[model samples]
Target: MVLRTARVGLRLTRGQRNRCFGLLRAAGDVWACILEINSWRRRRGEPPVAGYQQLCRLLTESGPGTFAELDTAGARSVLRRYSDAWFCAAARRKAGHTDVRFPRRRRALMPIRWYHGTFALDGRRLRLPTAAGCPPLWVRLDRLAPYPCETIRSVTLLFDAGRLWIDITAELPVATYPAGQQPDPDRIAGVDLGIIHPYAVSTLDGAGLLVSGRAIRAEHRMHLADTKNRRKAVAGRAPKPGQRGSRRWRKTRRRARLVEARHRRRIRQAQHEAATSVIDWAVKQRVGTLSVGDPRGVLGLPAGRRHNLRLRQWQIGRSLAILHDKAALAGIRVHLVDERGTSSTCPNCRTRITKPAGRTMRCRTCLFAGHRDLAAAFTIATRTPGGVITTPAGMPAGVVTHRRAGRHLPGAGRSRRDPRRPAAPGSVGRLRPAPPPSVGSRSSIPPGMDEDPQHTTGKPGER
Candidate 1:
């Protein structure tokens, strides 16, 4: 069984919201107290209490009711979070990562987690465990939990993007298929990850699938433009460092957070759709193994600001992770191999060629031309670890399938345009045209400049 977590928003009354935040604040206080104790211990030249049991002992010494409305189990979860983080940092540092730092910073609010049986889940309403003598805290979820209640392992209450959310984690069993319809382990497909085409999958049986990401790219660009415009509009209202923000500034910040959250949700949904498409295609083809090209090594390079922004928006790691998780659930194995030179090398003759500027990749040696990303996938398929690279019969002729990732995104459908964009120059519902150039006046001149061209009845070739 694999563990998966889904976040659901909370619908709460004013009192419930306050109480939830109170619990989170109490958890944060617990975290801060631990950090302070560790700091004092370090100052005294003593080993810090980073273990979960030791921290629990310390918490017990502090006595009960120390954190209002926070039960012992809930507080211990915070200690567990800190201990896990501290040990993770130590491990990373020991592995030659000097930049890794222990958790010492304080937070005003921290997410509190409760394991199964500690919290009560009843359809849309959750009963969170509170301190003894405290009234039971029940909050409603905006939507029903995705997983069954019996499979739920834990729930974590946290605040994000100006709203409260609970992440429900559940253990799910791997999917099983009927006999004679199971995925063939020998049948493999290569996946090429790209910016424009997020997933390009090529199988040994001469089939390819391309999932376009143009809508996602457009969403990113539009969000950046909107954010820049909003920031410019509110630059004067922005509070100076160490100064409290005005009410208007706070409202603007809240609006910004909402927009950011929406953008993130849209992108995440589209990525999942893209990954699902790839998995479905693989299942139909009876392909069990997916050879994914890993491109994370180049992300650390100092690209220009524009290129860096593009790379960041690409979200390559998340895309890969989503695909990997979905593939695993589908009983398909995913192997990430080094993708260097995959796009440039010709799959047929193995000759290195310059990366194409567009989607088409043409080989100078073998005169073979195909989609660039698919070509990369084909090459990647051949390089799967511990797998033979034998070409299937009639390999050059593959059935190509085209699919789009963000069809639900604004402006993605045929009948809908992005509401965020202004109307086109000649589109309907736009304001009426200006007076039809005023009967041969200078207003009819084309857009290059304001100057009116010299009018004459000259024929062709006349200056």
Candidate 2:
């Protein structure tokens, strides 16, 4: 079984919220205590108490009720977090990364986790483990847990964007298909990741799928504009460093957090939608292996500010992670291949060509032209490690299937307008009606004025 985790918001009363934060604060205190103990050891030229067993012993020696409302299992999870981080940093440093640092900084709040037996999940309600003498803390979830109770392994309570959330981790079995329709191990597809098209997949059978990300890009642009406007509006009210903020400023900060969270949720939802589309397509095609192009190498280069912002919004790592997780659940294999020359090299002639300015790539050597991303996918499909490319006959055909991600986005529909936005400049709602008829209108003017006296008195050119 594979492990998966889903984060869901918590619905809590004012008292419950405060209690939850108190538990988190207790976890933070535990973390600080460990750090302080280790610091003392360092000062005395002795080995630090970084081992989990030693830390548990230290905790036991401190006795009960030291951390209010925090149970042993919950506190141990904090120690586990620290131990894991410490080892991870040590391993990285050993591997020639000098910048990796062990966990030393203290936090005001730390997430507390409880194993399955320590907590109770009843439909939408969860009973968190507290200290022995404390009253039972039962909190409601904003929505029912996605996984079944039997599959749930642990729950972690944390705060994000000024709101409480719980990450529910569960073990899930890999998807099983019917006997005749199981994924074929030999069938492989190539995935080309990009900014405009998050996923461009091409199978060995000449079929291709393109998941457009225009809506996602639009969401990013609109969110950036909204954030800029908000910051400009609140700049004057923002407190200086070391100064306490007024209630109004705090409210603005909260609003900003909500907006940022909303934007993140929207983007994450769209990315999942895109990855789901790819997986569904793969399953339908009976494709088992996906060769994904890794473009992270180019990220370290000195790109301009605008390009950097674009790359940051692209969120290549998150895209890959979602794709990998979904693929694993579907019993599909994912391989990350270097994508250095995939976009520039022509698939037909194996000749290096300039990267296309638009989405269409043309090969002057062979006079072959097609969608740039699709071409990259086709090329990436043949690429294997050790600088070898295996090309099957009749590969990289012209047939392609197009799909769009984030169709649920506000501006993704045919209207091309977000419902939350005001009418555009030339739209019907914003257009002004023509001016009323002038004062010389026939109905409002006198009869003589309407007849034009000078013309009438001319007597038909008699002079």
Question: Quick one: best lDDT, which candidate?
Answer: 1
What's model 2's TM-score?
0.88
Q: What is the TM-score of each candidate against the true structure?
A: 0.89, 0.88
Minimal lDDT window, size 10, model 1:
454-463
Residue 41 shift from truth in candidate 1, angstroms: 0.6
- Per-residue lDDT tens digits of candidate 1, residues 123-169? 99999999999999999999999999999999999999899999999
lDDT of the structure predicted as candidate 2: 0.83
- Given candidate 1, what's the lDDT at residue 249? 88
Window of ten residues with lowest summed lDDT in model 2: 454-463
> Which sections of candidate 2 miss by over 4 Å?
240-242, 385-387, 394-398, 415-463
* lDDT for position 280 in model 2: 91
CA RMSD, predictions in order: 10.0, 14.5
